[model samples]
Target: MHVESALRTQPRAAEGERVETAERVDAVERAGLARSVEHTMAATSTVLQDFLDGRVRAAAARSDVAARLWADLADGVGGKLMRPRLAVAAYLGIRGGHGDDDSAAIAPVAAAIEVLHTAMLVHDDLLDHDEVRRGRPNVAGATRARLVGRGLKERTLADQVQAAGLLAGDLAIASAFALVASAPADPAALLRVVRLLAEGIETTVVGELLDVTGALSSPRDVDALAVAELKTAAYSGSMPLVVGAVLAGADDAQVARLGAVGSALGVAFQLADDDLGVFGDPAVTGKSVLSDLREGKRTELLRRAYAMADDAGCALLDAHVGRADLDEEGAAAVRRVLVASGALDAVRELTRATGLRARELAVDGVPEPLGGYLVGVVDDLVGRGH
Candidate 1:
């Protein structure tokens, strides 16, 4: 998916008041993830939007369209804090109880999750060569028009787009750090959280590099499990929970357990994402189906299928995997190959097993109420969008 899709924040709450709040975490699950996190994220979104709006208005006054673009950009990047909620859930798991004060404390950390997500999207879009995002044009997409308007050639546009996207990724990272720094956690703890954020970024980058390298290499040397765990799983599942737990003053053992939960959940979530990348509803997912196929992602499915494919099948796949123009028919053919080879089932079984592990880990050392809530959340995340 493109940066726009990745950065599309949750919708804003209604104006002139704080959004109506949901009482319990179960209430959130019942309401559906987008809505649950929409309400949870609404308050913080309002603040971020208002700030961006004011900035945009100021820029418009000065006739600086770039400023307006920047502000508008921020508005679009605000969204659901699914990963960060993992963090909050982890915190609650360790804290063993809840109240008004506890809820208030968790909010900022949750918001920080969104911040980090935004950073990842900005970078992912650049890497993917996507010009659009979240059903709208991205910074690069928007710039295309301006570039054409300025009489730039298509080749020049390509160069500038890539460069600008790289810069945008850097800016997104800066913004994520600012958000985490601005939260109400203890100074020392916040510093550690920030460090963790950096570490997650590094891990994700390494995964991305490996993924790209595998795509281009003759032998496709990377391990599918390693790629899935690092690129998609750890950050989205484990890091957020661990960070939240750390923020809530979880002891080392509790924090470690939360990390374990996150690791397993992250793997399951990534596997589900892989499945959805092939099989999801276009409307709900807000993207074309089989996007990963078109992108030639070196997912577990691809790796497993490749290994099992006969020489003829491997030769057929080698020609197909990285083709940007792979169409619906091509993707379907690939699905057929995966299914016939049993690779898809293998990946699915892996997802189910890992999800079970996550649930077990999530509850192992926590207080009852929060642990139960976390286990539910882990379950929700594991098969999400499937």
Candidate 2:
């Protein structure tokens, strides 16, 4: 989507009053978003638990497997609830208020989008071989723990755990579709939601494939950006807004504008995340600070570092990046090179630019309160420390 020039023409508020007013507005919007997220989370929990209970009762003979799958899926819930919140925000943006009837109508679809996100995260953990998420055992990790407690042989346990994780991801995907199908929306709107969900899955899979290819073979800057747009932007960012707007009967133009805003927001979010992957504290991020360097993940940060580095810096990067045995000292050396080459500053600047673009798009045509909230979200996302 093209960026609207008119967005830049909007008048800015005066300095001190603007700051005070913006803070007050942000606080109010944050409180509203928090309440919406809480409602969505409660509804999502009810839907998932009810589904799990019915499935377990129906498959009594295989109750253990059913329960395990539900546990895995449940573990993926209750994080920031970003997707559902975005959906609710977009819905409110279009509908003008969060009345009881509007909330009742929106919660089911919001829950569906959250469920869809959980499904993708389950699969993503498997793909990334991440054993922990949110500082707890992920699906694969939990499965491995269960199998290990059973005294299974190492090889057999690994195989069984992988299978369990795969099946849990599959169940989550199927349940996502089921949730959307049962949402209380018009038949035509439901059709659009279904199409959006299908497209999200397809786009994410293609992006994942590109990510794998980048890691293994190419790892170009363009490829890295493409992966971010397809994998993170489309499903995690744009689709939620689109779904909510469609449910609120938004016409095609509004939907398109929201999609563009979401895309820019998503890209900025990922860029900030890339910065964290390299420079953030492990305690705050709930991850090893060196994991990205160890894996040589194809992020724009790394791509820029490579391009800007001199021969000695390039040699340092080549020697340590992606090395499985890389130690703390090696990672430190790589970080030094990145800083010396100005890659970190370059990426930070890009992230700020992207956030500005998203803010501009939100102000262009998206209604007030929602537009203001969207800008607040961009600020919060790009400013995240973890």
Candidate 3:
């Protein structure tokens, strides 16, 4: 699902010349995306830092609550601000406005996205029973740490930690809604954005439930890929882009186009991510080796592999898939079976098709500078490891 592989089956400019031309095009797109993300991150960081600082200071008298929220915001905001920044960048691209006030207006909204994302992480960790995140303790892990520090007994500690993490996640979700409502934009647009964000979250939650339920049930008829699109793609990709378009005063057509692009790209991104999760280098992905395999979570790739497998292949997978006791060699063997079953190639083809649709959906009446920049953003996201 890497960028190169994602476009493998698509029409090319020409076999020999296409490589040279594509390389140049890809390089420019990558640079533009990097620049845009860099600028957006700078602005987002300032807003997030300021917001957290204010929150901490306001809660100064309430040390316990303030400290918990502060830790959540600080840790959550520091990671890539890609989602909210996408909204702001899209706004700027469409409106061609960059005044100080305009820039300031986006911070809270962007910060809201971070808040929402962190809340989702808190929930996701709870669902997956993950022990680590962003190379550190997640909300659940952090709560457990606090409980241990308090010298709570084992069962008491576990219950308290779980409860605290769940509540913290709920607070983060609430804060995100509050931040969006507080954005200094057109009141109507702010309300619309808030509503859309809530709907997107709900949609994603439904998809997540389906995914977890499917994993525990029979594998047949499970469209895990579609679930990935609905859950991860809808919120992570579409919502941010749509929010940006709304902020920019984009017409209905433009906003809809951005959403379509977001949806397609989001799916591609998630598929690639799933691939990397199991097969990627730990050094590069910043997670434990074969974490996804060890976790026994069902991904589109896994479902497809299982479906496409021969009798012997199915036997091999049945013996290994979702076995927490699997060793390193066992995981590698499963991967080999997946590749041999041609599931990887099929999924890769779907990724390419979706990416092309995304490119088509992305083309709209946006200003040239902004449009080019946005396209670059799409390219970099679908093409790179990050």
Off by over 4 Å in 2: 1-62, 149-151, 218-222
By TM-score, who's the top model here?
A: 2
lDDT tens digits, residue span 125-210, model 1:
87888777887777677666567778787799898777666666666576667667767668998899889988999999888888
- 48: Cα error in model 3, Å: 1.0
Best candidate (score: lDDT): 2
TM-score per candidate: 0.82, 0.87, 0.86
Clashing pairs in 3: none
Across residues 1-386, which tens digit of lDDT does each residue of candidate 3 receive?
Answer: 68876587455645757889766775665456446655665777777677767776766767866677567545654576668867777777666665556666666787788888888888788888774788888777777776687767889987876776687788778878877777778988888888888988998899888888887764546787778888888888889888887876889988887787788878988887777777667787665657777776677788888889898988888788778788889888888888999988887777777776777666564444555666766677666654
Ten residues in sequence with the least summed lDDT for candidate 3: 363-372
How accurate locally, in lDDT, is each candidate? 0.70, 0.81, 0.75
lDDT of candidate 2 at residue 313, scale 0 to 100? 93
Against the correct fold, how does model 2 do in TM-score? 0.87
After aligning candidate 2 to the native by TM-score, how far in Å is the CA of 237 from where it should be?
Answer: 0.7
